[model samples]
Target: MLHPCVVVSGVLLSLAVPTIISMESCEFSGMPGMPGIPGLPGRDGRDGEKGEKGQPGRLWQDKPQKGDQGEPGVMGPSGKRGVVGKPGPKGARGHQGLPGEPGEASHTDATQQSAFSVARGTATMPGRSSLIRFTNVITDFNKDYNTETGHFRCRVQGTYYFVYHASAEEKLCVVLKLENTIVASFCDHVQNHNSRQVSSGGLSVYVRRDQEVWLETGDYRGMTGKPEGYSIFSGFLINAH
Candidate 1:
């Protein structure tokens, strides 16, 4: 029988594989392989034309555009005056009143006596004597004795006043009374022959309708004079008030 020899294959089985080989060690290395060739740039594509605008939408046609803001509006005008109202009617008249009755009489006391008759005396009170009493009637005109009691009664409610004058050739004395009480007394024992005039104060007294005020004579025995003219104790009975 003859000896048989077989061969072994070392192929790199790849579609795009770089060929390589196994080698024994070398003393020096060879130069590196050349670089790959540069490739050409690709061409740019053309731009397409714009399409026609679509038909106006409903919102685009209907919506209002904002207008330029208008100038600030002019100020408002003033209002007109109102009409005057009508006047009211007049008021009614008032009713009449009834009349009043008369008043009663008035009584008075010592205050209203006359000026000349206030003092007691033997001589006359010149003009104011409604009633008078003389102690001794020596002469009609002689200053012999003016017997003023220096007092009188208040017959009515009014004012009264009393005064007196008295004289003698030598001795002189006067005594006056108010409400029967002695108010004043005077005497001039010396011969100068005093001629004195005295009067009561004008007093305001309110005596009821019919009250009494009395006056009396003194111890000197002088004449008791009446009240002055218009000097009644109760003459104020009229409704003069």
Candidate 2:
């Protein structure tokens, strides 16, 4: 036992000496690698604080500001006129015309072919003698005679003419009978020894148409001269109005 204990004590002492040397070297070296770079510069700092509030104020001083002017607006329309006035006056007149000529006649002249006769003691004479009367050709004849002096008148109105000539019997003379009396006469005896007496004249008579007219013998009172009595014959012409 005593012999090995001495060998063992020698070995443990030799091992403790090396471990102490390595630890000492590591401690003495100061930390091992290079140092790092520095950081960027910082931003500028903020401004200072606002000012303090003002005191209370009036309404006029606190009023809002005026807005900008607007574009121009459109224009308005015109008004109507009042009522009108009264009427005007009239114009002048015109001129006149010229005169005209005379007019023509309607009826022509009429004539009888032969004499109309009034027999002795006869009241009415022939009808066709009315043909001389342009008015009526159908009526009776108007006649008159005087025992004193045989004469006649034209009662109707017209232009009358007489034609007288003697027959074989006696010296011929005529009296105009109208309106129951004698208006005219031709008692002058024959100028020649020959038995025929002839006379004619125009008379303007104012008798109405269709009225009567006649001729008859004369009353020879104072005559120692010729044949015993006078025979009458006559024709007439009538013109119308």
Q: TM-scores, in order shown?
A: 0.24, 0.27
Residue by residue across 1-241, what tens digits does model 2's lDDT show? 5779778887877887787987986766577778767779889999989989988775585669899999888876876876676656665665665666767865532232112332222222213212111111222243322222323344434565544333322343445666556667655554465444434333445455445555544542111112332233343435534
Worst lDDT window (10 residues) for model 1? 231-240
Per-candidate clashes come to 40, 14
Best prediction by TM-score? 2
lDDT of 1: 0.37
Model 1: residues with Cα > 4 Å off, grouped in runs:
1-151, 192-241
Once superposed on the true structure, which residue ranges of model 2 sit more than 4 Å away at CA?
A: 1-157, 190-202, 220-239
lDDT of each: 0.37, 0.43
